[model samples]
Target: MSRVKTAGALNKYLHLPLVLTAVFILINAGVYLLNTRAGILVSGGLVIYIILILVIYGRQRENMLNDLVTFATQYGQVQRKLMMDLALPYAITDDRGKLLWFNDAFAELTGKDRKSFRKSIASIFNGMSPDKFPARDQEIEYETVYNRRDYRIQIKSVVLDDLIDNSQILERDDQEESSMLYAFLLFDETELNNYIQKYEDETMVCGMIYMDNYDEAMESVDEVRRSLLTALVDRKINKYFQDLDGIVKKFDKDKYLIAMRTRTLNELKGLRFNILDDVKTVNIGNDMAVTLSIGIGANNGSYNRNFECARMAIDLALGRGGDQVVLRDGDSITYFGGKSQAVEKSTRVKARVKAHALQEFIEASEKVVIMGHKMMDIDAFGSAIGIYRASRTLNKRAYIVVDSPTITTKPFIDEFENNPDYDSKMLLDVHEAKEMVDDKTLLVVVDTNKPDYTECEELLHRTGTIVVLDHHRQGNNYIRNAVLSYIEPYASSACEMVAEILQYFAEGVKLKSIEADALYAGIMIDTDNFMSKTGVRTFEACAYLRRGGADVTRVRKMFRENVDDYRAKGETLSNAEMYRDHFIISVCPSGNLESPTIVGSQAANQLLNIKGVKASFVLTEYKNVIYISARAIDEVNVQIIMERMGGGGHLNMAGAQLPKVSVEEAVRRLKRVLDATIEGGDLE
Candidate 1:
């Protein structure tokens, strides 16, 4: 193909001029017709002129072509010499990344001689893989550290046929057909990366620090030492930030603004924000230790946006209960120092404020749809009832959304089924709720804040206004767009939080005996009959329910288990295995029980009473999902362990659901998580 193309090019450039000259002789015949003597003289002169010109031109053309070939040869030699000893690091590899050839620069840098050069790029470059290479039309670049210098390698894929037509060095010997080859050119980017790293280290990280229990800690100490306690805390915080090359500005008595370089933030992260514990231990004869919540925002592209993210992160840390560090980097959020339980708020002023906000939302809305988590438990049902009661009080149409009510919630659901006082449309299914929602409707989510966990997640997007009321620790999968979000991890139950909100919903908010009973049942069930997580506010909510004609005896009788449930709980307990002499694990039998997951939770709670058990986990298979109920005392933090499996709750009580896995696989995963937790020293 090359020879044909070369011959055609020569014909166009060297033969066409001779053919034109012959056509000129035929035109001279017309001159001969006019004057024979003159035409003969002209023709003779023209023939002589053409002969001399062709002889001279032909000789020069030969010399010109030879000189051109000679120049091309030297040009090719110079190019070959330049590529062989080029200063830039360059190498050739086959499509599978096996080294074919390399320049002196690349050979010297890689210390690869011809004898030992038959290796893949992966062996030469620390992390290169064959699959990481680009295709024939595409180019790829990657960074690696060679020796002590950072190198940027740019790989260009070439078809062998494209190069062989142009250069002898690229000719193939072994391969019968054209194939792809990669040419690698490496640049020393050590100095550039050093500058980039310096800039990154200098990048500002904006954050906010808030004293989680300023008033409570102060009140716990003597009045005279309160000033000293305040001074000590301030000094501790200032010194801590200063040591990290940070600046702290006191915005309020309990709040501070902090600015630090990214390097400082990294140092703090490596320390796991130890200042959280250090600040708590700074007790100047105070009965209650003070805790701190830190929120940091980095890599948000601007200082103001970072500060805004910091504010949002701080709010999240507080919402999940304080005494933690939340790092917000754009859309990603991370938590550390959440080992301690959230401190319960002593003041009801915030509840009153939220209640007032709820009143405004309800009054402005045309209707309200109350929803709860799937497999609705007593706490979920009671919180829905509480919101339903509040909505009805404001003369707005209200409906409770329930999907496939579970056994634990059936009895309470039955209490409202035949009641003539309640409207027939008060209880709505998921499909009905989706149809009922509109721009004028208010969506109130109770017990669970995650949209997926809700009975009708579609309703959240359907309604313009959403109100989230939850007592569990806010997971990463939370309702981000809500008009009012009140997540109190410290509260015993969603019912307790709603009870407080109801107190301030109106001046004279009256609760029906059934409504009071439902609310009472939620708190009772969540707190395990007021034995776990019962703070002053928990009891206060229960007392208010009592005032509203909630009978403790009636609530217990309503939730009492049947014979099968009791037997299942006993079996779970008897089958429990002690892990590491502290943790207990067991499986609960469904045994025709409608709510086997709840039975697992009860079994987990029962396991904590064992002599050396610090935490308990009970697994139950129901509806193709393996539900794990986790319980722990102050000795261990179970929430973090459960979060690994995509669940979250309070420090003592948490649960997770593993879908599309066998019971044996779920148990193996649980054991792995437990082992990882133990190795990580989280339980300590």
Candidate 2:
């Protein structure tokens, strides 16, 4: 095999030499065939042929050398262009790891001159050795500082081939020759790192404490004591924020704004932000405990929105009688720490002042008209009669708006029918009331404040001047057009309030026996024979009625029901079901001589017979309207439960009017409210 290969190589080289010799012989032989002149020409031609051959060989060698140089230059230019166009820093190194070449971007990234960069890439990389770097085609990212600025750098290496013919030229083979080790590329992501840091810092959240009863606390304190207490509060607030890198700005005398980065919201779970327990110990005077209400707004979208929510929650906490914390998140509200009872306020001065104001309003109007709830009860009729007498003092035309068929006051109905002066037109319907109503007409609503419950809702709308006298607790649905609203929830009945108002205007007035009897009956029925729900004002109003010739025996007779009605009440109580800790519910079938309200109340009273029962509710159907009557024993808030069904009253006694719903459906809704209350969920 070696011999055959050697012969083939010799033949290929010998052919080139033989072809050159043949071309030289042909040129000399052609010159010899010419004459002496031809022989001289032939000799010159022979010399020229030899010279041309030498010139051709020299030109071929020069062209080969030029081509090699051109190829080397083009290769170098292509490599340089590739490095410049790349987005990352790159470098080329020899077998010994000495930097041979690097891009301009690399010099900028490392903050070093090209000469120093060639000596050491490790100086800019915090002394990281390339020799210690792992095998080629691998990449790593790390953080380092260049020119005192933080940076993130990525380094990569790849193997390059260095060969002459078929043999590798390593530095060990020839001291001056070295093999190419690797080509490295780097990426600078410092701007990306800065963006991530900014995002993390911005995501950190911040949260407030307000003094709710500031005015009530400082009302009786001396100036020196007040100043000291204020300073103490400020110091405590500052101390709480000191370790958190926060600030407490005093925006008002009673309010302070706290600002803190809430990178630790999870750690604050169940921790009291208001700190009212500590503040309450700081006494002002008169044994008045210093109380405060706090508002916390969390997970709010913006700083302005959070501040507004906190402010609103604080106001609600204060309005609900202080000593509480209210939390508001968007539309949701939560409460904590309002276990204390509201302080009883003195209303005698307010009542007296309101009496004078009402007198002026009554005197200025063209006429005085009184009305009450659609189904007029004893309280409603009695309060209207009491207002009628007050109108006589101003010599104004007095009218009572009512539906005669719906009147629950049987005796009063009989009395009006028997009287010669009593006219049927005097008991005006809502339409008739509207015709007589005007801006000058004064409307006095009694027994109830809710507009939908009023007998003459349109009369209120027709007349600009209005007044409301009610004993029930205030609800969201109230008579907004009224000029005078004498709503005293503490008062036993509306009759009591009207009776007191009548006395204020009763200096030189003549007493009417029928009107006096009506008012006395109203006070009796609401107070349950002066045994329950009676206050100091209740008996005082009853005493005024006795002075006006109101007979107690006749008042009792007005409440008399037939034997069958009494039996129905007993039947309702027999079917009651007790649930949860305090609630007792019962359903009574529709047919009965007694009204649903009376049956429901009797059923509620019977459920109270249970040992642990705190509240009782009776749901019964009558004339397509589901009547829900609720009663409680001080501890249970029945009004809140009833309000969820779109009705409201006092804390212990309440009723709701549901439209055309069945007893089963109503009971299901009632159970839902009870479950939510038991589970400590929001009422609405």
Candidate 3:
């Protein structure tokens, strides 16, 4: 092929031009000879000179062609020898990816000889096409098909200089019309990748294990039996980590720090941290079972940073109601094994201590600003009022921030706003609250602990000293850097928790009828009129409010709905559908209700009265946002289901909202979660 192409090029470039020059010289010589004898002699000399030049040009062209052919033949042999002698696997392919040649290493890598290298290199490797190959010089990592081995590949397109040690080829190799060849050098990376994976699997990880109900469990048994119960619990944990070669040390009476490798941690994640159930079986004559909250930090920073991460993880686990494992990787968090409910503690020591600490913060601040969540419900509003009364007892100027009140709580707020006996100046909007907040001001967040869910996130940011008091399950995005945090998932409502705090406030401080009534109504509404989530402490708080002149008859009248609202409630309930025999799901269409959240909760509460119903879900669409209210009986945990959708509450009742989705879509999503929960044996 090279000889044919060289001959044609030589004929076109050298032979044709020589023939034209010879014809012109002969014409000139003929004219000179016919015109004059002296001119004829001059033309003859010119013809001889021209013929000499032509002879030299032809000889030079022929010699150059012979050198090109010899170089092309030698270049092929040199390239072949170089490819064959390379230590790493190497292959050469044509412009179409057809394998032209391969070295012994490549043949050994593929378990084939040179004779079998007829297919495209990609076909033997991993079906790679020519277009996928690097057009310029590059190094890439890939895995082969035949032996499934990894390799670091270097590919370079063959250029003129590449053909013969800096010698330029006649045609441009970069042009599409030119036939180009690519060379590939593959270095085995399978062993290196295996070592890297083994290092990651053996990386050190730190974890903190907390006994969420340790105090309660220890109190349940006698002093003589307490040591025995502790030994049993310790044995269970030690035995679980024995095979992993984990190091566990008790940091406190109820806390432990564990060090283990990532491989063991992954195995524990696969088991869903079954040690929780194992420890629960160690009964110490307690009515409530023991549980643990574990925090794990993996692939984070160094050892110290991982330990700090573990501490934060355990705090999140406890905030989310204990009996769970929380894994932290930088800003990301994952939860597992939160099936059990948080056990209620019999003691109020923590509450009293928090109340005293809150009082000190209030007394030290120049002014106080109280706020609750957006679309403030009774529990949120009522809790704010309770804190307001506490602030008044300290003789400090305080303000309550409410941007817009919900329909259910608007009546109580209006009554408070009209009463001159109370300080009407205390009621303020978000703008006024932001202006009032300063470095010395204390911002007390009530009902909701999440910064995004507060009445005014800007106001929360303006104040230096802040406090968070909430009863909902601690979500992943709780407010950070609070002066005090009093989150009690075991409490029935934030109102109930606040009411308990109010009893331990400054001596002789009492709540008037209207203030007491608001707090009482908050408890009544959240507890479904004391029909659910009522414990001994829940009733005790209610009794304290009644003793302070809370009028239940008037509070009941406050919750009474008008004819239109009652009809909307009926319409929402009428759409209820059953799934898996005991689960109820419903969606309230848009434009049918002014207070979709309230009606949805009412409908969900109503669904529980039906026979054989284990859980209920009511979805309401208002202002392009779908609000879901979930309620469950003893056998089901609606909080876990709601948390999966980024909402939360207690185990029996929870709520979530989906923005920019239709009611039908929300219902479909809710049903899919319910199906998975049932399929996984998480719900009945």
Query: How are the candidates ranked when ordered by TM-score, highest leading?
Result: 1, 3, 2
Candidate 2 lDDT for residue 414: 77
lDDT of 2 by residue, 605-667 (tens): 767778888888988787788889887666776767887788977666789989978888999
Tens digits of per-residue lDDT for model 3 on 132-228?
A: 7765544444555346767767776774344443545543445455346788788788889889989988888999999988887877788898888
- Between prediction 1 and prediction 3, which has the larger TM-score? 1
- Enumerate residue pairs that collide in model 2: none
Model 1, span 1-684: residue lDDT tens: 112222567657776657767776776787798899978987997798789778977577767667767888999999978998899998889988899888889889988895567899898787788888987678999989989899999999887775676786666665475578999999999999889999999999999999998988988999999999999999999999999999999989999999999999999988989899899889779989999999899999999999999998898899888889889987899988788888988998889999999999999999999989988998999988988989888899999998878777898888899899899889988888889999999999999988888887778888779999999888678999999998888999999999999998877479999999999999998998788888999999999989988988888889888899999999999999887778899999986988999899999998988998889999999989999999988888899889887888889999998999988898889889889978876655
Q: In candidate 2, residue 97 scores what lDDT?
A: 53
CA deviation > 4 Å runs, candidate 1: 1-5, 8-10, 26-35, 49-72, 114-116, 161-178, 574-581, 589-591, 675-684
**Best of the candidates, TM-score:** 1
How far residue 473's Cα lies from its native spot in candidate 2, in Å, is: 2.1
> lDDT of model 3 at residue 624?
77
Output the TM-score of candidate 1. 0.92
Clashes of each: 0, 0, 0
